[model samples]
Target: MTKVAVLGAGSWGTALAAVLASNGHDCTLWSRRTEQAEEIAEKHTNEQYLPGAVLPDTLKADHNLARAVSGASIIVMAVPTKGIRKVCRDLNSVLEGPVLFAHVSKGIEPDTHKRISEVMEEELDREICQGIVVLSGPSHAEEVIRNQPTTVTVAAKNTEHARRVQDLFMNQSFRVYTNDDVVGVEIGGALKNIIALAAGVTDGLGYGDNAKAALITRGLAEITRLGVAMGANPLTFSGLSGLGDLIVTCTSVHSRNWRAGNMLGKGKSLDEVLDSMGMVVEGVRTTKAAHQLSKECGVPMPITEALYAVLFEGQKPIDRVELLMGRMKKNETEDLAGWS
Candidate 1:
């Protein structure tokens, strides 16, 4: 069994720690709050983030980033995207061993539009860093905590790295597939949250299944457009990280993005929605970044654009929906038609 370090104590991170420990790996869960770490270590519970899930006894916890991560064969990054750079920079100071990375984050850097792997490479800056891997799919912290069957894909620049992670996490309830399309995998994971929020908006407006079906179908088109524009394999968007993730997030009640969007669609302000959700609604920030990327990369994402208008420009949500519904039908162009 390999030793693994989990660098967050949030719901998703805690669930990941439980899985790693159940898989017979020695796992250390690290948190900035020592008390929270202490609670998980001693009581086997993280009452705030993951209610109703009993953590494994094998899951060790610590506050010191160095102590938790030291000498681990794999470092599982379960933190949000915004925290990755700071955590990596800090972890680099005390780590002496070569550690392979497996991150489950999903968001693009707003300023640079960098993928999570790019952010890792930028912060770590070591040739001997072992390898970098990204795992993403429809898995939610809630269901996975119940040991429900969930499937995910691991993508790395190197196929060897993907295979190694597959051995590390794949099991009876949690299955992992390997892929080499790093760009597509990362892009799909980040982009799907936006579509999920859009799905919630439609639901909030009381639109029927037809609207949601259209949004999911056409949203895949937009995600594919952006992924291809940014050098991802066109086919990857059709895979699990792309279409599979989109399906889960857009429909499932467990999706935080969908929850946040439900509030927004019901005419809640951004701050209000965020306050209600109590979790970092990644899609809110990603919508801003994606709107910026559409302009930079010359990609036309009408769905994203309308969502942005509702989110940032104070456009009424129902009005935006009506506008989208009234858009003229034409031959669906293949290459993000209006982007050019």
Candidate 2:
């Protein structure tokens, strides 16, 4: 069994640790809080993040950074995008040798607009990191922990490292696929949350499936436009990370982004929704980053702009929707001819 350290105790991290432990890997989950670590070890349940899920008994938890990564040859970074740099720096200080790093979090760095892998490369010592891989798709932690059938993709510039991560997590209930398009995968994963939030707003506004469907479809168009400008393959947006993830995040109750948007659409202030959820709604932050990125990339991301206005500029969600619907008309496939 391979030794793996999952460097976050949040739902996704805990669920991934459970997957590793179930596959007979010696997996340790690390949390910044000693109490959280102890709770996972003793209770086999992270009540705060993952309420009813029971983790594998063989899985270990550690509060100490050094202790958690001591013997691990593989590190699964599950920290939020906001915390990635600090965690990578901490890991770099304690790492003894080169190791394969796999990150599952999705979101662009607000100021730098760097993808998670780029941030990792900046913070982690080259001598200590063998390669950086991103693990992402439509899988949710709640369903994954239940051993429900799930499929996800791992991507890296090095195909070998991506396949290595695939082997580490694949099982009867969990399936893994490998892709070489790291930019596409990361972009698709990060931007879907923004569309999901817009979808939630549609639902909250009492708009029917027509509006939701349009948001998701047009949202993919916007995401693909930006991703292509940033050097990603257009076809990747049609795969699991793009269309699949967008659908799930936009529809599911388990999505924090969707829930937060729903609250906002129903008239709760941004601060109120955030306070009530008690968890990070990545879309909130990503919307700002995406809005800035669209401008920098010379891409038109109307939905992202609208969401940014609603979330940050105090424009009403309904007014933003009106703004979107009132945009200048063009052929649906106007800019997509070159993508094929």
Candidate 3:
């Protein structure tokens, strides 16, 4: 059995660890919280995150970072984007032997504007890191924990590593696909959360499906623009991590980003909304990174700009909507012009 160490123990981390364990991998989930580790190890339940779902019997949990990664073949970094650097630094100090790295967290670092994989590359010791793979798509933790049918893409520069990850997570209930475009996959997955939050704002403002449909479409174009400018394949934006992820996160009730946006639309302050949603809304931080990235790339991401204004500039959601609507009109295909 492949020895896998999944670090995080949040909903997504716990769910993924359960999948690995169910697939017969020797998996250990590491939580920073001692009590959380105790509960998962002893009770086999992560009630706060997974609610009614029970984890696999074979799955294990530990609060000790060294204990979790000890003798592991693969280390899955599932911590939040904000926590990635610290986790990687910790991993570098404790790591021994070569281990394949796969990251499931989606976000660009705000100041460095690095994707999760990029952050890993910068922090991880090159001698020991076998390769970096990214797992991303429309699959949600709530549904996946229940053994529901789910599909996702694993991307890496090394095709072999991507396929290996594909084998690691693929099963009847969990389907996996492989892609070589790491840049495309990471960009699509991270940027979609920004669009989903905007979608949530539309829903909260009592706008109908028409507005959401338009927002999602325009948001994809904006994401594509930024992604391509930043060295991503244009076609990747149309794949699972791109269009597929956008559809799920924007429409599903399980999306924390959307829910946070909904609260913002209902006139709650950003601070209030974040306080209510116990989980981290990745889109908030992603929006900041995207806003800065767009400026750096000289890409016109109006949707991202509007969301940024509402999120950080103290502009009202409704006002931003009007600003978006009143902007200069252009051919829809204009943005896709240079894409070959």
- Say which candidate scores most in lDDT: 3
What is candidate 3's local distance difference test score? 0.94
Look at candidate 2 and tell me the lDDT of residue 150: 91
lDDT of candidates 1 onward, in order: 0.90, 0.93, 0.94
RMSD of 2: 0.7
lDDT of 1 at 1: 94
Residue 121 of candidate 1: its Cα lDDT? 89
Would you give me the overall lDDT of model 1?
A: 0.90
Model 2 C-alpha lDDT per residue in residues 1-340, reported as the tens digit of each score: 9999999898899999999999999999999999999999999999999898889999999999999999899999999999999998888789999999999999999989999999999999999999999999998899999999998989999989998999999999999989999999999999999999999898999999999989999999999999999999999999999998999899999999999889999999999999999888988889899999999989999999999999999999999998888989899988697566
Show where candidate 2 strays beyond 4 Å: none
Question: After superposition on all CA atoms, what RMSD does each candidate show versus the true structure?
Answer: 1.9, 0.7, 0.7
Stretches > 4 Å off in candidate 1: 333-340
lDDT of 3 by residue, 222-318 (tens): 9999889988899999999999999999999999999999999999999999999999999999999999998998999999999999999999999
> For model 2, what is the C-alpha lDDT against the true structure?
0.93
Error of 2 at 263 (Å): 0.2
Q: Per-prediction TM-score, please? A: 0.96, 0.99, 0.99
Better of 1 and 3 by lDDT: 3
